[model samples]
Target chain A: MTAQSDQTTANADRIIISVDAMGGDNGPSAVVAGIAKSADKNPQVGFILHGPEETLRPLVDKRDVLSGRVRYCDTPDVVSMEDKPSHVMRNGKGTSMWSALESVRNGEAQGAVSCGNTGALMALSVIRLRKLPGVNRPAIAILFPSTNPQNFNVMLDVGADIRADARDLLQYALMGASYARNGLNLKRPRIGLLNVGTEEHKGRSELKEAHGLIAQFTDQADFDFVGFVEGSDISGNKADVIVTDGFTGNVAIKTGEGTASLIGALLRQAFEYSILSRLASVLAISSLDRLKKRIDPRRVNGGVFLGLNGTVVKSHGSADATGVSAAVKLAFKLAQSGFAERLAARVASTVELTQDAVELADPVPEHQKEGQA
Target chain B: MTAQSDQTTANADRIIISVDAMGGDNGPSAVVAGIAKSADKNPQVGFILHGPEETLRPLVDKRDVLSGRVRYCDTPDVVSMEDKPSHVMRNGKGTSMWSALESVRNGEAQGAVSCGNTGALMALSVIRLRKLPGVNRPAIAILFPSTNPQNFNVMLDVGADIRADARDLLQYALMGASYARNGLNLKRPRIGLLNVGTEEHKGRSELKEAHGLIAQFTDQADFDFVGFVEGSDISGNKADVIVTDGFTGNVAIKTGEGTASLIGALLRQAFEYSILSRLASVLAISSLDRLKKRIDPRRVNGGVFLGLNGTVVKSHGSADATGVSAAVKLAFKLAQSGFAERLAARVASTVELTQDAVELADPVPEHQKEGQA
Candidate 1:
């Protein structure tokens, strides 16, 4: 194995996660409970719970499993979900989520995990830790819950880059492929451009341009480019990684969330309407539960904001203890993999090639270069 | 009652629905089942099963309930979902779906029903019927399934009018309100702009402009405009009608759909893990079924394409018999309410006022007027 691979394996074995204890709807209690439970199961991993010292002390002291493994960082302020993204980025200096992120940026912790405001986390990351050298924008990549566990779909720019160009899309595809490789341990990640249809000439002008760019990357053997994927393909897991602008990705994820909840509720109602049907539902309860587990949001709460300088995992704002636990696990997995550094290195190398292509396509005049000097 | 309203109401009461028998995944079986079930319940309402005589004739004849109510329109061609929207609109002359839509356009039927390609339906509707005066684009308005049964949310431009301005959003809000009142029988629907945040000064510049226009309408009592709404508020039942450009709306709906399915599958997985859990799942199966019924896609499959000269209902592309039946029922309700005429009149009034406002704000110069002449 290569030295980098050895380091990754070592890091994976000794993962330390910085958890925002004061984040989410239920606060430190749920965070503490989840972290305590998780730490007990994973002896190789450690935790640094960031929150108000007073609040975290009692919770830590009460649990033997947590006290030894989990430490605290004194952060007084808690960034509420309702706070404006700009305001939080400016004023959240001492916030637990901010402090947790700082730990990751400073390399005190391998990864930062938070169930706080999404916009705030995104803005703070951009301002504080900064983007990877060649990354214009970082994308939030989520694995849509899938029936085939082996075929989880990675949807990028899920409320990160609202107005992304073809270059941004190319970066998303590259980053998503890297994520799938490291995070999901896929040998060859199939990259797909999420469009209105699967046709080569489908979608708006922007998507068409993006499709061409992705095709170019695939032709060069960068990743397994699977071409275009439609809205319906998301559920079917047609691609390992699906790329789109944040606006579309955000709405698509939300729509999927709403629809799944609606269907679950519909089935519940149908069983209630008649006694005979209710009994039949009782008989088929195992099958239903099996299906539910395959699509649980709580089980898959952590979504990594890829292309950042450091690993930053975002948990749902409405996440419970179960969701919080999953986020921590995801963070541990990401940190262990050394995925951020690998991605940054890959992007840095590609940037040089892309620059050369750009220069070749439209060479800058000698006079313009002299003027700059 | 006004002459138009009285005539429409009478027609609605005696409305004959022409269903595309060859449309949808389940084919004629589901269509026939839905029609038979509907005809048995609604004695006055009739149906025309449009498809190849061989395919549909036997299905209709087999059901006693469909004996007199269901007739046939001989159309051989079937527009597959995979077909191009433009091609289906231009060349699908004898397609069952096209024929069904034509039945409504030619006034041979009060309304048409189809569970075919949404793109094809939109294209055909725009090309064949022509848009209502002052309407730049026709929009699809879906009543999103909210948690509260009493307060369903209406989302407009759910895949139409890709590039929309403030004027277009205002028009959609007006049309959505009309649909809510007419089709849903909501007295006065509260309109909301689907925005990133609820703050007065949030979202893109276009949203700010649209917000101002909606506020103006609310002040004038045109409809109950309820300010802005975030993604989370969509299922919270805060607003009766949510208006957005089709691009965002389509993405949002699809995301919600994907997520809902994801969650449902997860829940299923959870119940099937172990024997003890399986027993617990069996005990809770009734509750689960009740929940499922509340979120049934079939119950909320039909979405009205508002701002047209006539009522056009788009069924879910993957809709079964119940979904098609709901679409037919929705069309009948809309036709009965005379919503199109009222909507057109309202929009015309608003357009006239807007023109006057523009003239007052920046009057055309003499040179410009002469150039126009």
Candidate 2:
């Protein structure tokens, strides 16, 4: 316990977070609220909320809580959630979101958090901070709600790139596993590829090829590769880390969110139908509360974009104050963990090995394929 | 209310159902229990439970209720949930699942319900029932739990074909809309194409192309076309029928299932943590019950395989007696509505119109390009 306390203190003192004050539904209010809550709890951490001075000043002024530690950076433009990705990347100079990214890039802040347009943020992060060496496309990793409160599952490429090859999937596995280990404080995280089925030939050609690559690496991989997992296995905690392309991951996340809300609404309606059932519902209130907290979206607010040179966290655009605060805390923890540096080194080593293997398999000409090796 | 009752009674009598007795966790016992319950309430409906005679005889022997209406078909094999699709299709001749499908095809039953291996069942149905002329792929459509109890949302291609083109999605929209009108008893079900955003250019190439087709048809089509919908919009009943490819749809449905279960588990834990919270939960029991009834998986047990020549409902493999019974009721509703015949005729007409339009523009290809022309 003492060693854990010391590590927490050491991490808190070294971490600096840059929050996009103009992002999300509640804007600077939620961002400021989250920062205030986090700062109050962790005295060693500091924050810089980027936005227009006039809009952000009052929110911070209302809270005398972290007046000294929480500072502000002025940026006139506010990027709306509906903005086009290319437009945001090209014209978002001096904007709050861009400035927040700049803070991480320039080393003024160790990490950044945003609840703005995901596409814009991804474009800006890659353009500004750049991808880690040997990483072709940076992927976003989200900790999806699982049955076990302490055993959350991480899904990668949750709307980063639409298309990914076998190599990209392999990189996602490595990055996601690393995230589970460092960010979630898990040792040798169990990784699984999200496929149509557990069978080797169950999915598309790309997945079949990826299965081979994953299988090859898992035999001697650094992490504990648990093999393929299906959609139903996600909530069952079949694996600590689940990896997939952005398209499937995005759809899966959205589906889970929609379904949970739908069920919750349905349960509410059922309880209201009759007086006798209402009485019975009262008897089952404890059971209901237990379910709510387990699937509370706010409790797991922040999702990190992996394979980047620095830490960048994305909160839901519709996030409230509590959600924003959680994002800030996540950003702080990630930055303090020194994950970027460790991932950079690991990825670099993997790339080197891959390059050497490719060179060894040097091809002859296309004409030689039929008769020569 | 009197008119609705009369119509429902008339509709119930015309419906014929074939149930797979060897399917599900509890097999014939649960199937028989559910059948007994339904048969007792609705004397007009007919049922045939297909399975091995020895295994099913004892389950039905004790129950005197609807003994005449409930008959059996001797089948040698049973398709387990985990059975390989190819293996089952090739080796499992005269299986309970195959025979149930065959009953529908032979006109002995209007529709069939199976709580068996979903993939294997789907494969058998596709091969035996055959697809409607002009239809490229058959899709699975399930009514999802919605925030509105009176109006549930429909999602298609939950686990049918993995790769789908624009035309297939267009077919899904049409079939789903028809199902919504018939199954949910809606006058004009609003159709929405599920994409990443409402923007025309937001999704993948397939979505972008599908969006154009939807826009063109919705403007002059028979149904109420409400335009695009996101993953978040599914639960809100923003659209009565939401259409997408099988892969995306399956992942989304599973995600929703997992998240709901996770949330329920969490709420239970919360209630058990302390006596005070448990007491508070009791006070809110009525609300919880209301919510549970609305989201009950059993209520929406049957999923229709659209674009097929005949009606086929895929019941959940893990379904209990209540769920199997609900599937039968849903299948009955679908058959009585004459939804398949109507949908078949509609598709035939649309395909003809599409072909005519293509032929008319064949001589002047430039005129076919609407944007340029």
Candidate 3:
């Protein structure tokens, strides 16, 4: 842990992270195993596991580390991986995924962590917790592997929705900056709007409008607005938070992940191609191991959904026990530092400027203004 | 050279590729140096160097491989990297960029290759060569390093225009598939539309429309339209051609290039970190060399401008001699196989479909229809 996290822990109250234990590809076993790992290390952490008592109790009981650290909620239904978001919304009332989020909504849990269908989890989070005041759209923020002082940089709107207007993009910059400040522990997280070019004249008109809007909030939001950043700057230290419409962000993240996976596969093939290369692989095993660990997607396993009354961290569905543990740890950290409340406060304060932003670029119709308000 | 290129040369005529020998980052020297390299190995390939005759003459005289085989066009004007496309179009006559394309326009050269500003090159290529009869907008096509049989996959609209409607996307599919068939020598190239997800119901609305349109063209274009593909397929061999709006493609390609560069930088740092690692590096030199060569950006150093009557391959402005040589080779291959005429022919065959696509998508405005026609 960094000194900032240590300082945060010293002042904050005990944090409980609710766990959705049923729908992950690895099932309840991985969730229970993850809870045990978290419980052993963080005494101030507690879990409210949501699943069928019959299925979860046996797994929780197998780990002595989870004893007295967990409280189970008997939710029998499970949202399958193939379930549509609309279907899950209508039928998911008694499911573990719904129960876990409801715990946060009802103030029973500080934050929720789920390894479920992304669309389902996002839909449930929005419907359960509702958007924060002044936030027209909630965004899903994730940490990309980086070469900065911080090992990760925050990127947001990774498919919460396919669209973002000038107003939504500005909101993302603020929300992403808040996440970077509290989660990554940057004092003034630098915010960059993702565009095709760093040049001022390039890209869509919305981006140019978003650029000016984000710039105005730098002094107010207590972060640096680092103009436009090209896609290359996402992994570099040039920006702490890279903001974009969910459509572009989603494609960029998937492309980076896909490229990394392809490179790993190619490296393996190269190593096994010849006896001399195989010998080299054996000799350079330590350095090669370091490289692999540095780029392993599993290490950066959680995507935090921001711009809501309550926070939710979506772990990868196919995550192993270690990945689930990482997500839980992230949720615990965000909860302990009172991130959800502070983020809500931040948005509420700057919201009038958000309205000002809309007026500046696009005027609201006099009749429609009341409805939007 | 791959067996494919060897075959292309065997059955093809002597090809002449025009070269814009000024305004690149390294100036005329690098351009001349690059032409020398391409001429030495490819016997049937020739060059028409365009620039100020006095400055370019000395450099061509330095290379014995270029004697008697070079054609010079005395154009004193040069397009600086800073010049805007609009500025170039109005005042760019006599510039090397214009002369290079003009050479192709007049049948003095089969294709044009330039390392000038991309926007300017694209603009000049459009104004001088004009769009192919059926092309609504010309796209900048690039070859991404991939694990395909050809070691590359073609991606288009990497920033020719920020906007692409359903009709424009359909044109890209037809144009890209044709390029893949001729340039990559794919009998039936598989085309994928870049999107946020592979699901039938995911992504923006135009994507759904574009998907349907491209599927309709698979039979007519003699290619396989492989529906939607996520970012992962960009580097994988899942599709031979990946198509998207210029905004998304530009960011994605930059992201991929930046990520690959970042990984390369990190790998070097890891290898040099410790004495044991340095020893391992010595032993693993062969494998590392192969890996380095495989991923080098210079090796895949050309972006082909499609949808124009003539071909113009844009090389990186700061590219060294090897990179420039790669661009020349690409231009030579396209020239040898009559790619420009073939691509124009392909789009001409689909000209009726192009009109149908626009009408199906959005009824043409009466005033604009005549101008568009």
Off by over 4 Å in 2: A1-14, A267-294, A353-373, B1-14, B219-221, B276-287, B354-373
Estimate, for each residue in A1-373, the C-alpha lDDT of model 1 and write its tens digit. 0011112333344677888887688878888887877777788777777888789889878888764566568877999878888899889998987888887877767888888888888999888789998888899999886544574788898887667887788889889988888888887788888886577756677777777777766644357888888776676666888899887787677667766665666677666667766775776666676676667788888889988889899988777778888888888888778888888887887786655444454468989857866
Whole-model lDDT values for every prediction: 0.76, 0.77, 0.86
Per lDDT, the best of the predicted structures is 3
lDDT of 1 at B149: 52
- Better by DockQ, candidate 2 or 1: 2
lDDT of 1: 0.76
lDDT tens digits, residue span A103-200, model 3: 89988789999999889999999998999889988999999887888978899899889999888999999999889999989999999999987878
Rank the candidate models, highest TM-score first: 3, 2, 1
Supply every candidate's count of residue pairs whose N, Cα or C atoms clash at under 3 angstroms. 67, 27, 0
lDDT per residue (tens digit) for residues A179-287 in model 2: 8878778777778888766766577777766666665555334787777787866776778888888888887788778877767666666766777657756766666
Model 1: fnat (fraction of native contacts):
0.28
Candidate scoring better on DockQ of 2 and 3: 3
